[model samples]
Target: MKKDKPKYKLIIDAAVVVIAENGYHHAQVSKIAKQAGVADGTIYLYFKNKEDILISLFEEKMGQFVQKIRNKMSGTDDAVDQLKVLVESHFQMLADDHHLAIVTQLELRQSNKDIRMRINKVLKEYLVLIDDVLQRGVDSGSLSEDLDIRLARQMVFGTIDEVATSWVISDQKYSITELSPGVHRLLVKGLCK
Candidate 1:
């Protein structure tokens, strides 16, 4: 019900910028409200507290993240093409939204253990998408029949994730999306027959 309100989205988007700039520890609810152009008390109508806002923020953005990747993966025949699309799409999306990258790569990792666990829960959907691609390759005889999909999925996700973190750490000095082809090449070599 609350999500249907315009203020809900306003608060969520505001939280992204606030959390990215201030870090979760220092991002107060009042600041978020001010950024959203709402009363500080209005934030409570949409969220229980700052923690709720943070978790909801992750849930919302990560949900869109997965959906966008899934959309990009659609209508692609070859598993190899699909995999490439996945890498490029992931990089391009993050690169296009630097604030989101900061929120996802940096601030998201700073929460408590329990909160991190919840964040991982959202991340699992994305990992599963990778697994599906690897599984498709194996089934279609494009990838090795003996391929360990679980490990491959982990490696693929790990590579993309580490590269993104490194880019963020390096202040995006280089083109992250431009590295997609090379990253996909390396990943494909390991997956194919």
Candidate 2:
């Protein structure tokens, strides 16, 4: 598959920077190729068009994002600890990658309906991870037994998402990672009490 190639990753990384700097609509393939230090035609070999690049880039980044959270949470068995890990990891990832933060919190939202739909498809895996943590919490009685998994998942994800977006909008003037504890506490309280 094209994803296995080094160039595919190069293009994806390049696309992230390009899209973040220029916004999705203005991120031309030639610009991405130049950023990746590849010929313009080379991108075609890996993607159908600009839209394909956007979808694939999101898919790749989000996959890595979920994996990173999983790895970080692996040391803990407590659902509450796992939830904290997820919140901390989510904020830390955006804090670590400013470009990625901009793209995800801003440019990605600016995409058309079809692209947004595809991005949602990619997001399902991450949501399932959240659901798993919530399920574990209910099982362990750390969270409300009456907790609606679907609603709680949305709230947890939405809260984390809003905080990140606010950071991006403020030009990242403050430490988003430092706010992780507060965010975690808020979610835990909602889930537990």
Candidate 3:
């Protein structure tokens, strides 16, 4: 119910900027509230505490992110084209929002064990999405039938993830989206029969 409210989105969007700038540990609820133009106590009205906010933030953002990627790749029969769409969408999303890129690629890594675990839980859905794409390629013989789906998923996800992390670390010095075609070709070639 709260997720449907305008203020909920405002708070979530505000948390992205505050957390990216301050790091998760230093990103105070008051700071996020101020950024959202809401009272500090209002944060508690929606979230249990700072960790809850962080978890909710990732859940909300990544849920939307994965859904968008799926939507983009839908109706595409070619596995290679699906891979390209995934690569392009992933890079474009971060490139479109630097603050979100920082929050996802950098600050999210600083979370505690429980927080990190929850973050990983959200990430598993994405990993599974990648796996499904790989399975489709195998089923259609676009990729090697004997390909190890697990390792392929790791390679695809790891490559994209490393690229994003490097881009974030470099202060966005270069175009991350420009490398999508190359990344797509490299991964698809390795996966192809």
Candidate 4:
């Protein structure tokens, strides 16, 4: 698969920077290629167009995001601890990659319906992870037995999403990771029995 190639990763990473700096509409294939240190034609080998690159970039980054959270969650069986891990990992990864944070929180939001739909499809895997944690908490009776998994999952994701958007909008003036514990506690309180 093309994803297994080194240039695919380089192109993806470069697309993140290019898209972040230029905004998706203005980001040209040449710019992405230059950022990746490859010829513009090389980009065509891996992607159909700019939209494809944007989608692939998100797919690549979000894949890593889910894997990292899963790895962190492996150390704990407690639903609450797993939630904490998810929250912290979410904040920390974005905090560590400013370009990625910008692409995700800002540029990605400006995408068209088709792009948004594809992005949402990729997001389902992440939302499912949250559903798992909420289900576990409810099963253990730590969270409200009457809790609606779908609603809780939305609230959890929306809260984290809004907070990250605010940070990106403010030019990342504060430490997003520092807000994780507070965010975790607030969400947990609502779901807890």
Task: Please give the TM-score that candidate 1 achieves against the real structure.
Answer: 0.96
Count of clashing pairs, candidate 1: 0
Between prediction 2 and prediction 3, the one with superior lDDT is: 2
Q: Residue 171 lDDT in model 2? A: 97
Taking every candidate in turn, the Cα RMSD to the unseen true structure, in Å, is 1.1, 0.7, 0.8, 0.6
Q: How does each model score on TM-score?
A: 0.96, 0.98, 0.98, 0.99
lDDT of all the models against the reference?
A: 0.90, 0.95, 0.93, 0.95
Clashes of each: 0, 0, 0, 0
Backbone clashes in model 3, listed as residue pairs: none
Q: lDDT by residue for model 3 over 67-180, one digit each (tens)?
A: 998998887978889899999999999999999999999888887888899999999999998999999999999999999999999999999999999999999999999999
Task: Give the winner by lDDT: 1 or 2.
Answer: 2
- Tens digit per residue, CA lDDT, model 4, 88-147: 999999999999999999998899999999999999999999999999999998889999
lDDT tens string, model 1, 82-191?
Answer: 99999998999889988889888888888899888988898888888898999999999988999998999989998999999999989889999999999999999988
Q: Give the Cα error of residue 79 in candidate 2, in Å.
A: 0.8
Question: In terms of TM-score, which candidate is stronger, 3 or 4?
Answer: 4
